[model samples]
Target: MEQIPKIIEKVSPALVSVVLIKPNKEIQEENQEKDGFVELETGSGFFISDSGLIATNRHVVFEVAGDYWVFWNNKKYFAEVLLRDPDNDVAVLKIKNQGKTPFIKLADSTKLQLGESVVAIGNVLGGLQKTVSSGIISGLSREIMAKDESYNKVFELKNMIQTDAAINPGNSGGPLLNLRGEAIGICTATISDYENIGFAIPSLFVSMAVAEIGAKTKK
Candidate 1:
Protein backbone atom coordinates (compact mmCIF):
# COMPACT_ATOMS: atom_id res chain seq x y z
CA MET A 1 0.00 0.00 0.00
CA GLU A 2 1.07 3.57 -0.63
CA GLN A 3 2.25 5.46 2.42
CA ILE A 4 -0.77 7.00 4.12
CA PRO A 5 1.01 10.31 4.62
CA LYS A 6 1.83 10.69 0.93
CA ILE A 7 -1.68 9.70 -0.10
CA ILE A 8 -3.15 12.21 2.29
CA GLU A 9 -0.86 14.96 1.03
CA LYS A 10 -1.92 14.28 -2.52
CA VAL A 11 -5.68 14.21 -1.86
CA SER A 12 -6.31 16.28 1.25
CA PRO A 13 -6.29 19.58 -0.64
CA ALA A 14 -9.19 18.38 -2.75
CA LEU A 15 -11.24 17.47 0.29
CA VAL A 16 -13.66 20.17 1.45
CA SER A 17 -16.24 20.79 4.12
CA VAL A 18 -19.82 21.26 2.89
CA VAL A 19 -22.04 23.47 4.93
CA LEU A 20 -25.79 24.00 4.55
CA ILE A 21 -27.28 27.11 6.04
CA LYS A 22 -30.98 27.56 6.64
CA PRO A 23 -33.23 30.14 8.18
CA ASN A 24 -33.62 29.72 11.90
CA LYS A 25 -37.24 30.62 12.41
CA GLU A 26 -37.30 29.52 16.02
CA ILE A 27 -34.32 31.66 16.87
CA GLN A 28 -35.70 34.61 14.96
CA GLU A 29 -39.02 34.37 16.79
CA GLU A 30 -37.34 33.96 20.14
CA ASN A 31 -35.09 36.98 19.67
CA GLN A 32 -37.87 39.03 18.01
CA GLU A 33 -35.61 39.38 15.02
CA LYS A 34 -35.42 38.49 11.35
CA ASP A 35 -32.79 37.38 8.86
CA GLY A 36 -31.32 34.83 11.20
CA PHE A 37 -29.89 31.66 9.77
CA VAL A 38 -28.35 28.57 11.32
CA GLU A 39 -26.25 25.81 9.99
CA LEU A 40 -28.57 23.00 8.93
CA GLU A 41 -26.03 20.40 7.96
CA THR A 42 -22.35 19.72 7.44
CA GLY A 43 -20.63 17.08 5.36
CA SER A 44 -17.57 16.43 3.22
CA GLY A 45 -16.77 16.63 -0.48
CA PHE A 46 -13.89 16.71 -2.95
CA PHE A 47 -13.07 18.65 -6.06
CA ILE A 48 -13.17 16.55 -9.22
CA SER A 49 -11.93 19.01 -11.81
CA ASP A 50 -9.83 22.12 -12.19
CA SER A 51 -13.04 23.91 -13.11
CA GLY A 52 -14.16 23.65 -9.48
CA LEU A 53 -16.59 20.79 -9.80
CA ILE A 54 -17.26 18.88 -6.57
CA ALA A 55 -18.81 15.50 -5.87
CA THR A 56 -20.80 14.74 -2.74
CA ASN A 57 -23.87 12.89 -1.54
CA ARG A 58 -27.27 14.23 -2.53
CA HIS A 59 -28.46 13.69 1.00
CA VAL A 60 -25.90 16.22 2.20
CA VAL A 61 -27.59 19.03 0.31
CA PHE A 62 -31.11 17.67 0.16
CA GLU A 63 -34.06 19.73 1.43
CA VAL A 64 -31.85 22.67 2.34
CA ALA A 65 -33.72 25.92 1.92
CA GLY A 66 -30.86 28.34 2.36
CA ASP A 67 -27.40 29.04 1.02
CA TYR A 68 -24.68 26.46 0.51
CA TRP A 69 -21.05 27.10 1.35
CA VAL A 70 -17.77 25.24 0.87
CA PHE A 71 -14.65 25.53 2.95
CA TRP A 72 -11.18 24.60 1.80
CA ASN A 73 -7.64 25.83 2.14
CA ASN A 74 -8.56 28.14 4.99
CA LYS A 75 -11.21 29.88 2.90
CA LYS A 76 -14.95 29.73 2.39
CA TYR A 77 -16.82 30.20 -0.88
CA PHE A 78 -20.39 30.11 -2.10
CA ALA A 79 -21.40 26.94 -3.89
CA GLU A 80 -24.07 26.22 -6.49
CA VAL A 81 -25.73 22.85 -6.87
CA LEU A 82 -25.02 21.54 -10.33
CA LEU A 83 -26.52 18.07 -10.37
CA ARG A 84 -28.36 15.71 -8.06
CA ASP A 85 -29.10 11.99 -8.41
CA PRO A 86 -31.28 10.98 -5.56
CA ASP A 87 -31.45 7.39 -6.72
CA ASN A 88 -27.71 7.08 -6.34
CA ASP A 89 -27.40 9.63 -3.54
CA VAL A 90 -24.89 11.67 -5.52
CA ALA A 91 -24.69 15.42 -5.97
CA VAL A 92 -22.31 17.80 -7.69
CA LEU A 93 -21.48 21.38 -6.80
CA LYS A 94 -19.76 24.20 -8.63
CA ILE A 95 -17.57 26.81 -7.01
CA LYS A 96 -15.56 29.74 -8.29
CA ASN A 97 -11.98 28.91 -9.13
CA GLN A 98 -9.36 31.59 -9.36
CA GLY A 99 -7.09 29.09 -11.05
CA LYS A 100 -6.56 25.35 -11.07
CA THR A 101 -7.57 23.43 -7.98
CA PRO A 102 -6.01 20.20 -6.79
CA PHE A 103 -8.16 17.10 -7.41
CA ILE A 104 -8.03 13.36 -6.85
CA LYS A 105 -8.21 10.86 -9.64
CA LEU A 106 -11.17 8.51 -10.04
CA ALA A 107 -10.53 4.80 -10.12
CA ASP A 108 -12.46 2.26 -12.12
CA SER A 109 -14.71 0.85 -9.48
CA THR A 110 -15.57 -2.13 -11.65
CA LYS A 111 -12.11 -3.44 -11.04
CA LEU A 112 -12.40 -3.32 -7.30
CA GLN A 113 -11.60 -6.56 -5.52
CA LEU A 114 -12.79 -8.07 -2.29
CA GLY A 115 -10.89 -7.12 0.84
CA GLU A 116 -8.95 -4.35 -0.88
CA SER A 117 -7.29 -1.74 1.26
CA VAL A 118 -9.10 1.58 1.27
CA VAL A 119 -9.05 4.84 3.12
CA ALA A 120 -11.72 7.41 3.85
CA ILE A 121 -11.09 11.10 4.48
CA GLY A 122 -13.66 13.60 5.63
CA ASN A 123 -14.90 15.99 8.28
CA VAL A 124 -15.94 13.80 11.18
CA LEU A 125 -18.94 14.63 13.36
CA GLY A 126 -19.27 17.98 11.59
CA GLY A 127 -16.35 19.30 13.64
CA LEU A 128 -13.19 17.33 13.14
CA GLN A 129 -11.99 18.21 9.69
CA LYS A 130 -9.79 15.97 7.55
CA THR A 131 -10.18 12.87 9.68
CA VAL A 132 -8.83 9.73 8.11
CA SER A 133 -9.75 6.07 8.51
CA SER A 134 -8.54 2.93 6.83
CA GLY A 135 -10.28 -0.38 6.19
CA ILE A 136 -10.98 -3.03 3.60
CA ILE A 137 -13.82 -3.50 1.18
CA SER A 138 -16.19 -5.66 3.13
CA GLY A 139 -18.76 -6.21 0.41
CA LEU A 140 -20.08 -4.94 -2.93
CA SER A 141 -23.38 -4.43 -4.75
CA ARG A 142 -25.21 -4.01 -1.52
CA GLU A 143 -28.82 -2.89 -1.57
CA ILE A 144 -29.69 -0.86 1.44
CA MET A 145 -32.86 0.93 2.43
CA ALA A 146 -31.88 4.16 4.14
CA LYS A 147 -34.59 5.93 6.02
CA ASP A 148 -34.44 9.68 6.45
CA GLU A 149 -36.43 10.58 9.50
CA SER A 150 -36.23 14.28 8.70
CA TYR A 151 -38.01 13.81 5.38
CA ASN A 152 -40.08 10.81 6.38
CA LYS A 153 -38.84 8.93 3.38
CA VAL A 154 -36.76 5.89 2.67
CA PHE A 155 -34.35 5.55 -0.23
CA GLU A 156 -33.14 2.39 -1.82
CA LEU A 157 -29.45 2.53 -2.61
CA LYS A 158 -28.27 -0.12 -5.03
CA ASN A 159 -24.83 -1.39 -5.94
CA MET A 160 -23.18 0.31 -3.01
CA ILE A 161 -19.61 -0.31 -1.90
CA GLN A 162 -19.51 -1.70 1.61
CA THR A 163 -16.44 -0.99 3.70
CA ASP A 164 -15.39 -1.40 7.27
CA ALA A 165 -14.03 2.15 7.39
CA ALA A 166 -15.41 4.44 10.03
CA ILE A 167 -17.93 6.79 8.42
CA ASN A 168 -19.54 9.18 10.82
CA PRO A 169 -22.34 11.72 10.38
CA GLY A 170 -20.15 14.41 8.84
CA ASN A 171 -18.31 11.94 6.66
CA SER A 172 -21.05 11.84 4.06
CA GLY A 173 -19.95 12.83 0.57
CA GLY A 174 -16.31 12.21 1.30
CA PRO A 175 -14.07 10.08 -0.86
CA LEU A 176 -13.36 6.38 -0.37
CA LEU A 177 -9.95 6.03 -1.91
CA ASN A 178 -7.72 3.13 -2.87
CA LEU A 179 -4.04 2.94 -2.02
CA ARG A 180 -3.25 4.75 -5.27
CA GLY A 181 -5.13 7.79 -3.93
CA GLU A 182 -7.90 7.33 -6.45
CA ALA A 183 -11.49 7.76 -5.43
CA ILE A 184 -13.30 4.46 -5.79
CA GLY A 185 -16.47 5.57 -4.11
CA ILE A 186 -18.25 8.45 -2.39
CA CYS A 187 -18.96 7.83 1.26
CA THR A 188 -22.72 8.04 1.66
CA ALA A 189 -24.12 6.39 4.72
CA THR A 190 -23.73 4.10 7.73
CA ILE A 191 -25.96 1.92 9.83
CA SER A 192 -26.50 4.16 12.81
CA ASP A 193 -27.09 1.19 15.09
CA TYR A 194 -24.10 -0.75 13.86
CA GLU A 195 -20.33 -0.48 13.96
CA ASN A 196 -17.66 -0.39 11.24
CA ILE A 197 -20.20 -0.97 8.48
CA GLY A 198 -20.28 2.03 6.17
CA PHE A 199 -21.63 2.40 2.67
CA ALA A 200 -20.50 4.43 -0.33
CA ILE A 201 -21.79 5.09 -3.81
CA PRO A 202 -19.59 3.43 -6.36
CA SER A 203 -17.44 5.69 -8.52
CA LEU A 204 -18.89 4.23 -11.71
CA PHE A 205 -22.19 5.92 -10.96
CA VAL A 206 -20.34 9.13 -10.14
CA SER A 207 -18.51 9.09 -13.45
CA MET A 208 -21.75 8.55 -15.28
CA ALA A 209 -23.38 11.44 -13.46
CA VAL A 210 -20.49 13.74 -14.28
CA ALA A 211 -20.60 12.75 -17.90
CA GLU A 212 -24.34 13.25 -18.09
CA ILE A 213 -24.05 16.66 -16.51
CA GLY A 214 -21.24 17.65 -18.82
CA ALA A 215 -23.29 16.64 -21.83
CA LYS A 216 -26.24 18.67 -20.68
CA THR A 217 -24.08 21.70 -19.94
CA LYS A 218 -22.92 21.76 -23.52
CA LYS A 219 -26.44 21.77 -24.86
Candidate 2:
Protein backbone atom coordinates (compact mmCIF):
# COMPACT_ATOMS: atom_id res chain seq x y z
CA MET A 1 0.00 0.00 0.00
CA GLU A 2 1.09 3.59 -0.53
CA GLN A 3 0.90 4.30 3.22
CA ILE A 4 2.90 1.24 4.33
CA PRO A 5 6.24 3.03 4.55
CA LYS A 6 4.88 5.63 6.93
CA ILE A 7 3.42 2.87 9.13
CA ILE A 8 6.74 1.08 9.19
CA GLU A 9 8.53 4.15 10.47
CA LYS A 10 5.84 4.72 13.05
CA VAL A 11 5.92 1.11 14.34
CA SER A 12 9.56 0.14 13.99
CA PRO A 13 10.47 1.62 17.37
CA ALA A 14 8.39 -1.00 19.14
CA LEU A 15 10.10 -3.92 17.46
CA VAL A 16 12.70 -5.86 19.46
CA SER A 17 15.15 -8.69 19.24
CA VAL A 18 14.78 -11.21 22.03
CA VAL A 19 18.01 -12.69 23.21
CA LEU A 20 18.80 -15.68 25.41
CA ILE A 21 21.89 -15.79 27.60
CA LYS A 22 23.23 -18.63 29.66
CA PRO A 23 26.33 -18.51 31.82
CA ASN A 24 28.55 -21.33 30.68
CA LYS A 25 32.23 -21.83 30.22
CA GLU A 26 31.69 -24.10 27.24
CA ILE A 27 29.75 -21.39 25.46
CA GLN A 28 33.07 -20.03 24.34
CA GLU A 29 34.10 -23.44 23.10
CA GLU A 30 30.86 -23.96 21.23
CA ASN A 31 30.75 -20.62 19.50
CA GLN A 32 34.33 -20.07 18.54
CA GLU A 33 33.21 -18.82 15.16
CA LYS A 34 31.29 -16.06 16.89
CA ASP A 35 34.41 -15.05 18.77
CA GLY A 36 33.21 -16.16 22.19
CA PHE A 37 29.87 -14.48 21.82
CA VAL A 38 27.43 -16.31 24.08
CA GLU A 39 24.20 -14.50 23.61
CA LEU A 40 21.70 -15.94 21.14
CA GLU A 41 19.33 -13.76 19.20
CA THR A 42 16.52 -16.21 19.54
CA GLY A 43 13.49 -14.41 18.13
CA SER A 44 11.71 -11.15 17.44
CA GLY A 45 9.06 -9.40 19.49
CA PHE A 46 7.08 -6.18 19.76
CA PHE A 47 5.97 -3.95 22.58
CA ILE A 48 2.24 -4.41 23.13
CA SER A 49 1.86 -1.95 25.96
CA ASP A 50 3.45 1.38 26.84
CA SER A 51 4.44 -0.15 30.19
CA GLY A 52 6.89 -2.41 28.34
CA LEU A 53 4.86 -5.59 28.00
CA ILE A 54 6.12 -7.43 24.93
CA ALA A 55 4.35 -10.15 22.97
CA THR A 56 6.23 -13.01 21.38
CA ASN A 57 5.89 -16.73 20.70
CA ARG A 58 5.91 -19.14 23.61
CA HIS A 59 8.50 -21.32 21.90
CA VAL A 60 10.84 -18.32 21.74
CA VAL A 61 11.21 -18.27 25.51
CA PHE A 62 10.50 -21.96 26.09
CA GLU A 63 13.98 -22.68 27.30
CA VAL A 64 13.85 -23.20 31.04
CA ALA A 65 17.42 -22.27 31.66
CA GLY A 66 18.79 -18.97 30.37
CA ASP A 67 18.00 -15.37 31.09
CA TYR A 68 15.96 -13.51 28.51
CA TRP A 69 16.49 -9.95 27.41
CA VAL A 70 15.49 -7.68 24.53
CA PHE A 71 17.26 -5.07 22.43
CA TRP A 72 15.47 -2.05 21.04
CA ASN A 73 17.15 0.94 19.52
CA ASN A 74 20.55 -0.52 20.45
CA LYS A 75 19.65 -0.54 24.14
CA LYS A 76 19.31 -3.71 26.18
CA TYR A 77 16.66 -4.31 28.80
CA PHE A 78 16.26 -7.28 31.11
CA ALA A 79 12.94 -8.98 30.51
CA GLU A 80 10.82 -10.80 33.05
CA VAL A 81 8.54 -13.55 31.82
CA LEU A 82 4.91 -12.82 32.55
CA LEU A 83 3.36 -15.94 31.09
CA ARG A 84 4.01 -18.74 28.65
CA ASP A 85 0.61 -19.88 27.49
CA PRO A 86 0.45 -23.62 27.91
CA ASP A 87 -2.11 -24.07 25.18
CA ASN A 88 -0.96 -21.43 22.72
CA ASP A 89 2.30 -20.46 21.07
CA VAL A 90 2.17 -17.03 22.69
CA ALA A 91 3.92 -15.40 25.62
CA VAL A 92 4.36 -12.07 27.32
CA LEU A 93 7.39 -10.43 28.93
CA LYS A 94 7.80 -7.26 30.92
CA ILE A 95 10.54 -4.70 31.23
CA LYS A 96 10.18 -3.04 34.57
CA ASN A 97 10.01 0.71 35.03
CA GLN A 98 10.04 1.37 31.35
CA GLY A 99 8.24 4.72 31.93
CA LYS A 100 6.79 4.88 28.42
CA THR A 101 7.55 2.83 25.34
CA PRO A 102 6.23 2.64 21.82
CA PHE A 103 3.82 -0.26 21.24
CA ILE A 104 1.82 -1.69 18.37
CA LYS A 105 -1.91 -2.02 18.49
CA LEU A 106 -3.38 -5.52 18.28
CA ALA A 107 -6.11 -6.07 15.71
CA ASP A 108 -9.03 -8.44 15.43
CA SER A 109 -7.98 -11.42 13.40
CA THR A 110 -11.53 -12.61 12.84
CA LYS A 111 -12.19 -9.83 10.40
CA LEU A 112 -9.13 -10.66 8.30
CA GLN A 113 -9.87 -11.59 4.71
CA LEU A 114 -7.92 -13.65 2.26
CA GLY A 115 -5.93 -11.56 -0.23
CA GLU A 116 -5.70 -8.60 2.13
CA SER A 117 -2.29 -7.00 2.24
CA VAL A 118 -0.04 -7.66 5.25
CA VAL A 119 3.51 -7.21 6.39
CA ALA A 120 5.92 -9.19 8.52
CA ILE A 121 8.66 -7.61 10.62
CA GLY A 122 11.26 -9.73 12.36
CA ASN A 123 14.89 -10.50 13.08
CA VAL A 124 15.49 -12.56 9.96
CA LEU A 125 17.41 -15.72 10.80
CA GLY A 126 18.30 -14.15 14.15
CA GLY A 127 20.90 -11.97 12.49
CA LEU A 128 19.14 -9.36 10.42
CA GLN A 129 17.25 -6.80 12.45
CA LYS A 130 14.52 -4.46 11.24
CA THR A 131 13.74 -6.83 8.40
CA VAL A 132 10.48 -6.13 6.61
CA SER A 133 8.52 -8.30 4.20
CA SER A 134 5.24 -7.57 2.51
CA GLY A 135 2.57 -10.02 1.42
CA ILE A 136 -1.12 -10.75 1.51
CA ILE A 137 -3.29 -12.96 3.65
CA SER A 138 -3.45 -16.06 1.47
CA GLY A 139 -5.49 -18.18 3.84
CA LEU A 140 -7.14 -18.24 7.25
CA SER A 141 -8.03 -20.63 10.09
CA ARG A 142 -5.19 -22.81 8.97
CA GLU A 143 -3.79 -25.63 11.08
CA ILE A 144 -0.18 -26.66 10.82
CA MET A 145 2.43 -28.71 12.65
CA ALA A 146 5.64 -27.14 13.81
CA LYS A 147 8.51 -28.43 15.88
CA ASP A 148 9.15 -26.74 19.15
CA GLU A 149 12.93 -26.87 19.20
CA SER A 150 12.98 -26.20 22.90
CA TYR A 151 11.31 -29.56 23.55
CA ASN A 152 12.24 -31.55 20.44
CA LYS A 153 8.58 -32.24 19.85
CA VAL A 154 6.14 -31.42 17.09
CA PHE A 155 2.88 -29.74 17.93
CA GLU A 156 -0.09 -28.64 15.90
CA LEU A 157 -0.88 -24.94 15.70
CA LYS A 158 -4.44 -23.95 14.93
CA ASN A 159 -6.40 -20.92 13.73
CA MET A 160 -3.27 -19.42 12.29
CA ILE A 161 -3.13 -16.49 9.89
CA GLN A 162 -1.49 -17.57 6.66
CA THR A 163 0.62 -15.07 4.77
CA ASP A 164 3.10 -14.94 1.95
CA ALA A 165 5.55 -12.72 3.84
CA ALA A 166 9.11 -13.90 4.06
CA ILE A 167 9.76 -15.57 7.41
CA ASN A 168 12.84 -17.33 8.76
CA PRO A 169 14.23 -18.86 11.93
CA GLY A 170 14.37 -15.64 13.93
CA ASN A 171 11.08 -14.29 12.68
CA SER A 172 9.14 -16.26 15.23
CA GLY A 173 7.33 -14.04 17.70
CA GLY A 174 7.56 -10.97 15.54
CA PRO A 175 4.51 -9.12 14.35
CA LEU A 176 2.40 -9.81 11.27
CA LEU A 177 0.97 -6.39 10.62
CA ASN A 178 -1.67 -4.75 8.51
CA LEU A 179 -1.07 -1.71 6.35
CA ARG A 180 -2.26 0.33 9.31
CA GLY A 181 0.69 -0.99 11.35
CA GLU A 182 -1.66 -2.84 13.64
CA ALA A 183 -0.36 -6.27 14.57
CA ILE A 184 -2.69 -8.89 13.19
CA GLY A 185 -0.61 -11.91 14.07
CA ILE A 186 2.64 -13.11 15.58
CA CYS A 187 4.98 -14.48 12.95
CA THR A 188 5.49 -18.10 13.93
CA ALA A 189 6.64 -20.62 11.34
CA THR A 190 7.16 -21.18 7.64
CA ILE A 191 7.86 -23.98 5.22
CA SER A 192 11.46 -23.58 4.21
CA ASP A 193 11.08 -25.35 0.89
CA TYR A 194 8.11 -23.32 -0.21
CA GLU A 195 8.05 -19.80 -1.53
CA ASN A 196 5.53 -17.26 -0.29
CA ILE A 197 4.21 -19.46 2.49
CA GLY A 198 4.36 -18.32 6.11
CA PHE A 199 2.14 -18.80 9.10
CA ALA A 200 1.40 -16.61 12.09
CA ILE A 201 -0.41 -17.15 15.33
CA PRO A 202 -3.46 -14.94 15.20
CA SER A 203 -3.47 -11.70 17.19
CA LEU A 204 -6.36 -13.01 19.24
CA PHE A 205 -3.88 -15.27 20.99
CA VAL A 206 -1.79 -12.23 21.87
CA SER A 207 -4.88 -10.50 23.15
CA MET A 208 -5.64 -13.53 25.29
CA ALA A 209 -2.13 -13.46 26.72
CA VAL A 210 -2.43 -9.79 27.54
CA ALA A 211 -5.78 -10.34 29.17
CA GLU A 212 -4.37 -13.14 31.30
CA ILE A 213 -1.52 -10.95 32.47
CA GLY A 214 -3.94 -8.19 33.35
CA ALA A 215 -6.11 -10.59 35.28
CA LYS A 216 -3.11 -11.71 37.31
CA THR A 217 -2.04 -8.18 38.09
CA LYS A 218 -5.38 -7.44 39.63
CA LYS A 219 -5.38 -10.53 41.79
The C-alpha TM-scores of every prediction are: 0.90, 0.91
Q: lDDT of each structure?
A: 0.86, 0.84
TM-score of 1: 0.90
Candidate 1: stretches off by over 4 Å: 23-37, 124-126
* Clash number for candidate 2: 0
**Candidate 2 per-residue lDDT over residues 1-219, each given as its tens digit:** 788788789888898888887655646565643433367647889999899999998888887666887877777788998999846789899888667999999999989999999988875334476778899999999989888776889888889888988877656688999988999999988986899899999999989888888898899
Please provide, for model 1 over 72-176, each residue's C-alpha lDDT reduced to its tens digit, 9 standing for 90 to 100.
878878899988888998998989954788888889999999999999988533457788888999999999999866588997999999999998765678999
User: Residue pairs in steric clash, candidate 2?
Assistant: none
User: lDDT score, residue 210, model 1?
Assistant: 92
- Report lDDT (Cα) of residue 139, candidate 1: 98
Please give the lDDT score at residue 34 for candidate 2.
42
